[model samples]
Target: MQNSIFKTAEVTDYIVQWLKDYALTSGVKGYVIGISGGIDSAVTSVLCAQTGLPVLCVEMPIHQAPSHVSRAKEHIAFLQNKFSNVQAVEADLTPAFETFKNAVPPSDNENLLNLTLANTRARLRMTALYYFAGLHQSLVAGTGNKIEDFGVGFFTKYGDGGVDVSPIADLMKSEVKAIGKYLQIPTSIIQAKPTDGLFGDDRSDEDQLGANYDELEEAMLAFENGIQATNLTGRKREVFDIFCRLNRINQHKINPIPVCKIPKELK
Candidate 1:
C-alpha cells in the first residue's frame, strides 16, 4: 500500500514501476482499459499511460449505463489531450446484452437474476476488450482492486476479472484513491462510490458485499499486517465472517478450472 505524501516523486515511481512489471509479465505492447468514469479506471489509465505504452480506453455501456458515459468520454479526452498515444473507443452493448437475456431459458437458475445480469455486462465488456487487445496486440488493463477482491467475492468471475494484466489488483480501495489523487484524476471519479453498474441504479459493489470499503480495508490489513483485532467492533467481526465464507466459496471463481491431460506419447 502507498504511504502518505501522495503526490511525491516516490509515489509516481511506484505507479510507473508497477505498470512496467505488468508489461514485462504479459509481454504486451500496450493496454486496453475499461474506463467507467470511476477512480479505478482513471487511475489505471493514467498509470498505463505513464508507462509510455499506447492506451485504449474503452467504454462498454449496457442499457442501464448512465450519463456517466459522457463523463467517461470527458475523462478519455483528458487522457488523450494530456498524454501521448491514448485512444478512446465506445462500444455499445445494449443489443448483445438484451440478446443474451432473451436467450436464457426460463428455468435456468431463477434465483440469480442480478448475478446473471451483472455477469452479462462484465462478460460483454470482456468480449470487446479482447477484440481490441487482438487488434492492438495489447493486454487488458483490469480495474478490479484488492479491497473488492477481499470482500464478498464481488466481481464477476472471468468477466471483469479476466485480464492479461492488472495494475491495481494488489492495492486496497483507499490506496487506490490515494494513488488516484496523486495522479490528479478527476475528483468526481475519485469520490465516486463504486458500483459494478451491471444491474440498475440500485446496484453497488459495497451493497452487494453487505459491507463497505472501510471494513474491507480493516480485514485486509489484519490478514496482510498480522495485526491483532482486540478492539474490533461487532459489525466488523460480522464483516470478517462474511469475508471468510466468501473467500472459501469463491475460491473456485479465482482459480482456473483443472483438466486432466494424457501424455502425448501415450497416445
Candidate 2:
C-alpha cells in the first residue's frame, strides 16, 4: 500500500543521502546539474547543493527555448546566493544544435532524423556539460523523475541519461512535487506547466508521450505494485506500452552490463 501522506523531511533526507551515497560509490569529489528551469532539475539542484559538495549549475538553452532561459538563470542565482558552494556557468547550445542540423542533412532513413536529431540536441547539451564537469572535477547529475523515465523510453539513450549520478530517478512525478515543497523550492517552479522545451510553441513532453503525468505516474506505480488490472485507453494505452517496452528493453540503463566470459581452464 502506498503511503497516503507523503512526508516532506523523509523525502529530503532520501535525496541528501542519495548525494552522499553517490560520492562514496563513484569516489568523485563534487556534483554538476543542468538547470532547465524545470521542477525536477530545480529540486535536484537544491539537494545537490545541500550535499556539501561543489555544485556547478550549467544553463544550456537552445534557440527554441522560451524566455525561461533567464528564469532558469534567476533560480540558479538564488541557489548560488543561498548555497556557498554553488557556481553558475552558461553554455549556449543554440549554435551547436544548428550546426548539427545543417551538417547532418536529412537522410533517407527518416527515423534517423526523428530519433537522431533529438539525440543530437541532448548530446550537445551534455557535450558542454562534460567540459564543465571535467573542469570542476564533478559528477554529472541526472534529473529524470520516475514518470518520465517510464514513459516512451522518453529520453534519448546515452544522451540525457548520460550522467554520473541520478538522485530522483526513483521518485514519481507526484512524489517529486511533494519533495520540492519540502525543500522550500520556489512555488513558481512547483506550479509551472510541464514541458521539455525541446521545440517551441508550447510543445511539451505529454504531447510526445500521448500520456499525461497523472496517468503515467499511476500506471507506472500500478505496474510496480504488481497489479495487472490497471490499464490506459486508446492512445494512452499505446503510451503505456511504450513505457513497458522501454522498461524491459533498457534494464541495462540502470545496471552494470553483464558479461559471461570463459576462463582459459574451463575452455
Candidate 3:
C-alpha cells in the first residue's frame, strides 16, 4: 500500500501555514521555485501560492523536452488563474549550458562527461532561480522529497538542493503526489513521470535510480527503523540489498563533510 500518513487535509493546511509563517517572519517579499512540470514542483508551487505571498514560478528549461515545457506552462497558467499573487517566468538556459559544455574539452569517457553536463544544468537552474529570488527579495523554495533528498541523494549538491527553504523536504514521493491531488494541481503534471530533466538522453528518474520510489522509500524506512536486511528473503531480500548498497554509496551526500581537526600540539 502507498504511504498514507501525509494524505490528510491537516497536513496540507500545516504546510501551507508553515510556508506563510516562514515567508512573513523572514521578511521575504515572496517565494521563488523552479517549476519542472513534475508533481513535486506542482505541489510545492501550490503550497507557496496558498500563502498569499508573491510566488514566482520559473520554467527554466535547459535542453528540456517540449512536452515537459508545455506542462510547466499549463501549471503556471493554472496557478495564475487560481492565485492573484502567483506569477510565471521563463529563463531558458540552453545557450548558457551550451557555452559551459563547449568550454569543457571533449572527453573519451562519455558517461562521465554526460554526468558532469547534467549536474551543470542543475546548477544553472539553481542560479536562475536565485537570480529571480534576489530581484523580488524572495526565498528559493526547493521541490525535493524525502526519499530523493535524504534517502538516495538523488539531487545534486548545490544544484536542485541549493535553496533558501525546503517546504516539502520531509514528504515522500507518494506523499507529494497525494498532496498534489489535494492542491488541485493540473492532472497532466500530477500524472507525469518524474524526471530530473538534467540528462539530455531523456532518461527517466527510475532508469537512473535503478529502483522506483516505492521500493526506495520502503528501504529507507526499514533502514531508519533498524530493520535487518538478513531478515528478508526472496524478492524482499533483493530489494533490501539494492537499498543498502545505494545507501552506502550515497551516504556522503546526506552526511556532513569530514573536517580534520588538528591537535593542540599541532596548533
Candidate 4:
C-alpha cells in the first residue's frame, strides 16, 4: 500500500539525511543497532549505513530461532558488502540469558513467566547494544516503527525502546516495508513474518497481537480520526477493540515516564 503523504524514495532519502544530521550534530561516531533480521531492523540499519558513518550491526540472540539467525547474518553481510562503514558482530547471549533465568526467583504463573522472560531477552539485547555504543562512541539507533512504537506499543519498554535515537519510529509498518524494498533490503527479510524473536519460536507478531499489521494500521488510523467504536462492526470492531485495548493498557510504554514532584515549599 502506498502512503499518500510521502513517496517511498523521498521518504527514504529524507530519513537517511535526517540520520546523518542527527549523528553529526550529536558528535557521535555512528549508530549501534541490534539486528533482529526483521524488516524494521534491516531498513533502519540500511538508513544508518547511508549516513557514511560507522554503523555497528550487532546480533545479540538469546535462544533465537535458526531462521532469524540466518536472516540476520544475511542482512549483515549485505550491509557490509554495500557500505564500507557498516560492521557486524554476533554476541550469543544464550548463556547470559540462562544465567539470568537461574538467578531470578521462580513464579507460579507459567504464562507470566514466559512473558517476563521474553521481555528479558529484549532488555538483554538492549544492554548489549548500549555496551557497544558506549565502547565505540556511537548512539543506539532504535528500529521501532509507527504501528509498534505508537499504535499498539508492542515494543518492550526500556528494552527495545531504550535508545539514543529512533530513526524510523515515525513511519508506519507499510511505509517501512516500502522503504525496505526501495533500499533493496534482502527479499528474505522483507518477506519474512514479522516476529519479535523474543520467544525463540516461529510465532509472528500477528499471532501474538491477534491481528495483522494491516488490520491494526487501519484501526489506528480510524482511532486517530476520532472514529467511534460503536460505528465499527464485525472484524473491524474486533480489531478496533484490540487496538484500543492494547493502546490503552500499553500507555505506560507509549508515554513519557512519570515523575513525582514535590511542592516548591516542601523542596
Give stretches of model 1 more than 4 Å off: 1-11, 21-27, 108-110, 224-231, 256-267
Q: What TM-score does each of the candidates earn?
A: 0.86, 0.84, 0.94, 0.98
Clashing pairs in 3: none
Sorted on lDDT, best first, the list reads 4, 3, 1, 2
What RMSD, rounded to one decimal, does every model reach? Answer: 3.2, 3.2, 1.6, 0.9
lDDT of 4 by residue, 1-267 (tens): 446776888888898899999999998899999999999999999999998999999999898899999999999999999999998888999999999999989999999999999999999989999999999999999999999999999999989999988988998899999899899999999999999999999999999999999899999999999999999999999999999999999999999999998899997
- Candidate 3 contains a number of clashing pairs equal to 0
**Which candidate number maximizes lDDT?**
4
List candidate 3 segments past 4 Å from native: 4-7, 262-267
The per-model lDDT (C-alpha) reads: 0.78, 0.76, 0.86, 0.93
In candidate 2, what are the lDDT values of residues 164-236, reduced to their tens digit? Answer: 7778887778878888877777777788777776654466677766667776776676577775535457655
- lDDT value, candidate 1, whole model: 0.78
What residue runs in model 2 are displaced by over 4 Å at the alpha carbon? 24-27, 108-112, 150-152, 229-242, 245-267
Greater TM-score among 1 and 2 belongs to 1
Model 2 residue pairs with clashes: none
Error of 2 at 252 (Å): 6.9
Query: Would you list the clashing residue pairs of candidate 1?
Result: none
Model 2: residue 226 alpha-carbon error in angstroms: 3.2
